[model samples]
Target: MVLIGSHAYGKLPDLPAVAQNLTGLAGALRHPSVWGLPDSHCTVLDQPESAQQALDALHAQAPLATDTLIVYYAGHGLVDPYTDELYLALPASEQGRPDTALRYEYVRRAVLDPAVTARRKVVVLDSCYSGRALIGEMGAGDHVTAQALIDGTCLLTSTAETRKALSFPGERYTAFTGELIGILVGGIPEGPELLDMDTIYREAHARLAAKGRPQPQQRNRNAGGLIVLARNRAHPHSQAVGAPSDPTLTRLAPRTVPLLRRVSRRSLLVGAAVGTAGLGGAGLGIRQLLLAGEKDAGGGVGSAPSHRTTSPPAAAPSASASSSPTPTTPPTTQTSSPGGGAPRKALKPGEVAWRKKIPATDDASDVLLVDDVLVLNLDGTLHGYDRASGERRWTLRHDAPFARRLSGAAVGSGVLCIEDENMFLQGVDIRRGTKRWGFRLATEVDALDAMPPCVRGGIVYAARTGASLYALDLATGKKRWSYSPTGGVGANPTVNDTVVCVGVLDPTGNDVCAVDLRSGREKWREEFGLIEYLAVDNQCVYTCAMGTLTGLDLATREERWSQPGVRRDPTTDLQPLTLAGGVLYTTTVDGLLTARDPWTGTVRWRFNVRYGERFATWGQWSSGGGATPIIDGQTVYLGSLAYLALPDEAAFREKNRATHFVHAVDAATGTERWHFEAGGATGTTAVDATTVYVASSDGYLYGLAR
Candidate 1:
């Protein structure tokens, strides 16, 4: 195996995700000395030409047929919107000029030239539009199995062609590469081998989708056989976490300390029963699980809830019932809570409260509900509808005709705040459908997602993709203050202890700048290997970086404690860390939802969001809040779209039918209560006291009874 990255761009501000990408994937390999094959080298190239030269030399090496040759590239993959042509950016890359970048299609074909005798030739890419590396088009980003082979040539990518690939700001890898490394280092849970590319790709595709990232694409067109590399070696592999090493981390070997949570088999089995309840009439018609964390002497996760319905659900109404052209009235759901007119429970087992197709152009943003009104930002318009009836109430728009898509959105200060396509932050009056204010940064970077920015004290703290951290006055849309510690600021600004902490990343390294909210002056700055994302409470800032989960004192900026390689299951997406009930709630890129003791960084409990698949895990989303877990009361709701790679698909499908699911887990004990699988739910699920609103990529905004 060989690794090479070209991120030290001379013209473009360096693509730092590349360096982090190669390091994490290359770190776990035990070399020829350990396994005794021709040595697998991990190399970082300075420029595109240099990387190409190195790869050419590898092909020239031409040794024994027994050896397997691998090539990995992490940088920019550009697709011309007009011509649909693909190009890979080199260090000297200047988008749109010829001879400035390498043609990926040509290079991909070059790698498989028959003269090279190595039995297997693998090409892995992490860049924008990398999926185009495969000559064949992949309709879905999540799963691709090799159909035919011409030689020992195969390929894997970070994301599909239309979307950009993302990296954790302070981690050692991009989403796809990190997950690839994890799968390589940690073998399948109970089984032994983790070698097959097909197996690896399936799991990686699923993991990326779990966290809301563009699914990785794999095309093993030529490899005739499984190429096995490395062993299932396990040890206490502790990371210095690639930074200005801190005493809090160095004092203890991270692995020696016990994990805060462990997987509860009994609770999980019961949870799966609830998740699969509607799959068949045989599937239990359970409504909810027990309120978790109800402890006995053992202090274990709570038991299954008592909301069970033995009867089969009523037949679903015709699709026209909700979509028909008729004056609407709030439909009533029969519930035991108080008046039967209002819905008080989530969807009953096998029952569809209502499913209406949205003529929506984009499904990236979620549905927001406030009282009886539901809001959805679709195709440059914010459409409002009646929560109970799904009737259109109002529509707001400010974009040029058919020219806009949303990055993300939030509701605050009586306005529907949105980050628009041109990097403009706009606030629209929610009730009147009028634009209050719009602010566009001078830079060209896109502000994709970061929980739609934090709103407090009449100012909005916003972070943008092209690299900027600014505080805007909500009333006038004027910049209160601006900070750019690094060229790229992708994560959101978090406020706690009266200080604003923002994580920035570029080729230099990952740095967290703590600025005094009042003065907008830097109070302290910490440099780490990388900063993935941060969540803060009154005393601590929970950080998921360097493949480890750590906490930093909010005021002092001192490390409180750290858990190295926290999610050891070969899954890498930006793991979301949240603070609730004095415990940290986290969801991994691989679908493990966990509760941890904040004081000690000890895990309290673990629940697999993918539900009951044996030897299965989660997928990812490009970071900035799409897949982050949201806590509503004692319940945590998440949208899960899992890809199952099973030994027997028939058996697995019989038990669990839907790959796309929405689940509610107990915040206290991390026990899942109920799961509803409808059209694929994409992001943080929005809810009100009476209804759980979910926006699906399948063009429907489901109004489930809650």
Candidate 2:
């Protein structure tokens, strides 16, 4: 990989500032990993004597067939308005412009010669009106002179002739260069067959759109036989042909209401009665009364039957002296009344397939279903439970005080990676849950908390609150590389094969960055002001900043599109968003659940729950709950406060405080399906197809079944 920039013009009076331009070029050059390669393999050439010299060096150090090559230039690029010939800037010796700086065709001739040994070549150009510099002209076939010079070369340039490229003061690189770096580092990795130039060009184009910059254009020349590998299969819903089908739709057996929703109403009432009678050993004492009602309904009696009388059953003993004694009810049963009546059975509370209590002193903070293992973060330890049985398998302990606050956990190569608020990175044996290694990053930075760590291949990437990024080995916890953005990193880093996408807060603005996972070099950078949350699927990266949501093409670091004015109240802070089944779910500070279209950014529906006293006070104490909303298929789950006052208001006033309720809403219509008072559920809820699990601050984990 090579980076070339020539901004150091000596006393050039008419041309734009070259030194400023070259500085930006150098920053990009030194960071080779940004181009999706290991830093050890890259070289930078700041000022070349001639196009021949630059080409000579590139070809002389030919890369192996297995290696990928990337070349980038950030300087003045001009084209002959008539012939549309491209040229790159060179240092001028005098105050006047030099006609012999460097022709685009000559640069192409030097670099594209088939004599070069590299298998794949990517060229990025950032210049004024750089779009016209691409190899092919408008409406022309792929075989331009530039394309004919090299085999398997891809070219990306700034803007078309009609659109102006953006440059900012104190920016080491222009928007184009920044966006290119963002994509190169973070773009998804494709297989050898898909590693072609045209794909890179398309990825870059998308990144620019997200940055609110003029869309970059590409001209494909000699790409007929080239194969551009895709990092992930295209989304089945994408406009692109041959999109991959969603496995969730294909693999799972169709839902059949699970035999519970089919029960009749009369059966439910009988089951409830039987359960009560069994506890009291009343021996079907209420059967006669129930049968009499049926006879009247059949018109067998002139007037309603006299009410039956029965003695109340004795109360059962209490488990504790501080609480009143309660009856121990027998499980309900299906039974028939007299006169050969139809049988009835009440719906039973769903069975508990399995349950396990956390250590008495600890509580679970999060649970992740990774393959067959259920990983739980409880107190300050990580535990793995069998998903099918909820049986504890193993446990790994970390020394960080705030380990319970860890948000993200990913598994790779049989190693589990986790990040804690203390900026501690922990890696554990996935099967045994034994601590393999751990590292404390930014020991001197007090505010530096590491976001959740994501693992790809054998490497783990994490972002820190202080604007730092770290790549570590999955097995050894060794630091591979680190990068600091102009702003601090707050979002969890996401890793595809080649790039690591991170959200950062910088002096210019809050932005998302794509860094080369191998070299810690920035591949692309796109700025947004006050970014809040980020999530990525197979095809696009979704981010929320201010009140708006934006989607960018993951491969190009370009914004494919955006949704502005999302109508969120300024006072309501948004929590991390979750996307599943083509829907995006998020929560506002005031406890409203909002769902929107992931592609179009249109709100599907919003559900609001009335807050009770405890929730209102908790919001006042903690700013607002940062719990992310949960989604399972077509249902959205959220926790809210519901207050109920005692009838004797003066007496036991303190005991009648408000309670928290977990509400399950239908995703399609935003209507509440069921509301259960859970009492002080301060954290997020988790769900499988049949059950919803939530934790309460009152020291319990409640499981409710559908």
Candidate 3:
């Protein structure tokens, strides 16, 4: 473990709390209940004179540890004005002179060196714009964030890429580090005996949010959370009377520790009820099992305060529902209701239904409807709420370390399917918040990644990137059949009753592969430049690649129509194509909303959705936000990323701030009706008969009504 802190600077204001941050964190790390590393093992680099000096100490100490390597930095982080690269300030470092300071790239290169053979690596950055390290080369002052996660490592940052790290006037240490150390020494009550990186980060994030501080961000890969950092001293066994030696107080081991399975009270009760005859007496058996599980699991079924719900008020006529002539209904399969039943009433222009505050960081985490329950995944936990009242119904936690934007989710057969942190496809009961089954998707790096899983009938189709596609039973999670194309399935599959169409990533370029839905037999394969989005119906399969949209016949396997200059980003645009009401809705090359004919790529109309801009900057109003439009009745709802221009000095210090807004537009003429402003950037959304649920980056889930 190497702890570095720089508290002095030449031009910029000094950060005095960095010194205490190092001292406090070191003490917590050496505690008997924590890591308990010896004095000789822990290295302290206080106020290193040069970047090379810090790199030398880090490289020297990193290679000796065979178990885990922990490197933490607490200092003023500087960003280059020209390149937007990050730097760590030293004692003699100036604000704008990055050459005189320590380049974070040098430190990253050292920690990622091949000579460092530590079993696990963890890096903690408690500085401004530290989150930039999570990505590859960044854009020149763009407020948009991207992910290029490092494999086999865990990274925790103090703030977002465009935000500043906070420290109050008289605090002992920095905000993020202080909260982290408190959790390490104090131990999380009702938590597991072993504290992993995921658990620690979740607790600290919640604590800092409650205190109105900037929330932190984390990224993990290759099971980095399995590397246990500290032992929980607050477990009941640690204070038990006349008990055996408490394992929670033991010293750290050199190998990874398996996470204990958390058995909820509901599961234990069901288990007892199923085998009451074999358990001798129902009363005594139930009591004992409940006691055992409740000791560690604090919140579960029948916990009134934790899982509270309020009845939704009686429905009334929408005041803003102006009586317009009902338009002709199209003969399309897509409907707003999950059951494909009657369509719901569209939200009117400039109407507000309900607004809620929620912790929604992952843009890939979608809003799904399972009957009357609204399901959303925040961080690593799955949340179910009442769709009508916005009341939380239940929550189920995943043991994995980090949440990924590409970890897609789907809902069908009354079950919600999602890829967890361990790369396992888990089928969860959307209404009850219980796990039905889990299926392993990959076992090695060759089968490392997967696109979002799509469900049809009783079988769920999942594609492992560059690997084979598997059809699993939604109820049992057992593999029904597996299909491996020459090139693996690259994008999410679109399925109808008979066939499943997937975008294939070949060695040379990309292709579109179609397979039989039930038998997993290859039907046909064709070449496309690089698929960005895909959709399917009974007659044709639509694919967007290289800024072009093409329609392929289902039977002939020939191109039906081709149109160029279709704009999309596969990493962020989860649902770019919406086929409904006999019309296709998509974004154009210039980020304008356009209604097109699916059979013949002819645009009906285009509407400019970019409205507000705080500055007259380049590309500020060029493209619309990336969120896909949600269509119901006659209105299309879309969320966008808006910019906020700060004062001249503040804008120079930080490039710009980005906010979010949701707009309602007419589906017929492509005219924007109403738009509701949100506190942060928006993600995917789900709608009901009268309510539209939206997920935002400002830690809020909103429900807009007419």
Candidate 4:
């Protein structure tokens, strides 16, 4: 195995992530549970001075490989404008000069040389335009010898022909290689015992798509994808691991869980710590919560409805005590509705409207409100219920035999868009509860899901998750136009009346740009840092990146204001901005709901979640457990998703069930109006004039009303 990375570019933008990629990938390949390659077998070339250094390394290593020969490179990829051939960039390479770099043809010839006796060969490229390597014939054949074929070769590239590879500013590794290392180390639970090339590529592709990064390109010849690369470390009976004696290799850490969307991110049932802590801790907590569910069914603290019934029963009145700390001022009573609705007789704030116990998995999307129906996406099924009565109205399940899960969904303009496991975005008429049109995004499917699409103004703005941003007409489901940035779409598109803004991932650094809504032309672009979240309002565009919250004026397209410290901890802190009623609502890693004036960046008020003695543990406070604040009328519904912490290891083992709460706070004053406890951690919430719908991980959907 030969690993090569060039970080020092003379004139072009340098990639600092290359060095980290080399170290991390080498470790994953040497891990006992993975490839277990001997120390002498793996060769790493970091910042090679010239093409000869790399060529010499490959020549020296390829002949000794008896089973497989793997060649991996990470750096800038240049295309010769004259011949349009790919070149692997090095330290002396420039932006437009491809002659200074190493021609990729030489590398290909070395992989297919007759002297090398390796049965299977793999070439992985992590550079811009690396996919151009797949243009020509791969294996050699001869009619004189009855068309004898050479060994099959598999090639994986970081980006397509026109796209640039991405390396976020603060990320430890390049976006493409980071995901690859993650799978090799963490291992796919449902994958086969031996991880093959195709399985690895598909898993990495889906994960990148889910985060709105660039999708990779792969080319396999003569069953090349079937070549086994490593053993699945996630399997139970894999290997009894041993410590590595090599000083250069360290055990690779698990990948950080992504921020899905504003709604899905905040609606997650568990925290990042639990998500990365492995299945043991999470399983123990879930088991304890299952017992709590039984207690709720038997009339203990929680409210459980009849099993799988359409109209189960109305929940009992919830307690009115404040679960958080006491506020400086009490919430004032309001008689008139602010958002254009007549005031009716108001019930107690925590009172429940209805509760239904459905067979929902923990991976539920945000509860969606569409006209007269409430739509909820479970694993592979979509269930629609009557908004007023909580009775089941319709159901739709994905029909794909292999990719049966639904990744994400969006509802607006009387239409619903659901992306199935097959990467097909299906448009459903929400009023009639039937499929309107279906558009297949990709030909492949896997366990990874995508971010929900954005629907507005008779158009559905969707992304191919790292490839292109597309605008689809709602009426016809035909694509209006697509804009492919230098990198790929980094996140879901944020649209407005005049322009649509998106975060574009790149090897240099991610960018946030605005495009004309009608023409799909580039209006303006601001080269920003790694974009965590993107949002737009009538007057300005807001983005959170590198712990700073920046606002750009819409008409002037200039920086309005910038505020740092929004995200103190990059890994765990998620600063999702919600713009409503001219106020920018953001959450902090320390569990504070901060309301800011969007124009001047002035602080309006802040609502803090206090973890009392019962929930206290060692660590900083959480970012409201990834739940973004949802504002409706004059009320803001905030689901404080559970962050599990215990006083000791014994308590963490025995009593792992942590309770979550939904607090209805005064939108204007940031004071808690009421709070309701759930059987398990709460996710995102959807609210109407009269009721608030909450999705809980404990397999119940509660309709809380005033």
Per residue, candidate 2 scores C-alpha lDDT tens digits across 108-214 of 55455565444445455666555545322210000111122233445555765334455443333455654443332223222111223333444444444323355
Give the lDDT ranking, best first. Answer: 4, 3, 1, 2
TM-score of each: 0.46, 0.45, 0.47, 0.47
Give the Cα error of residue 111 in candidate 3, in Å: 64
lDDT of each: 0.49, 0.46, 0.57, 0.58
User: In model 3, what lDDT does residue 489 have?
Assistant: 73
lDDT by residue for model 3 over 30-142, one digit each (tens)?
Answer: 65445455576666778777877877788787777565667677677777664456687777788789898777777767766787766556777888767555433111111
Query: What tens digits encode model 4's per-residue C-alpha lDDT throughout 1-706?
Result: 5677777667877677777788788877665556655576666677778888878877777777765667787788887764556788888887678778888878877877787766566778888777566532210000000000123556777775556777665467778888887777756654555666656776676566546566676655433554566665554444422222332222354334344333343322110000000011122221132223322221001111111001111111111112112333221111222222233333455656557776645443346665456776655677787765666788876574212212134543456676765666788876567788877664433313354466544567776556677778765678888898866777557765567888888886678889888789988887888876677755688887776788888888788899874433454465456665345777754556777777777776777754422234445342243465665433567765443333335545233232256777865567787888766556567664345787665677777753
Instruction: Locate the minimum summed-lDDT window of 10 residues in model 4.
Output: 270-279
Candidate 3 residue-wise lDDT at 233: 49
lDDT of 1 at 131: 54
Segments in model 2 whose C-alpha atoms lie over 4 Å from true places: 1-364, 370-378, 382-397, 411-415, 486-490, 496-498, 517-519, 553-569, 613-626, 639-659
Candidate 1 Cα RMSD (Å): 26.1
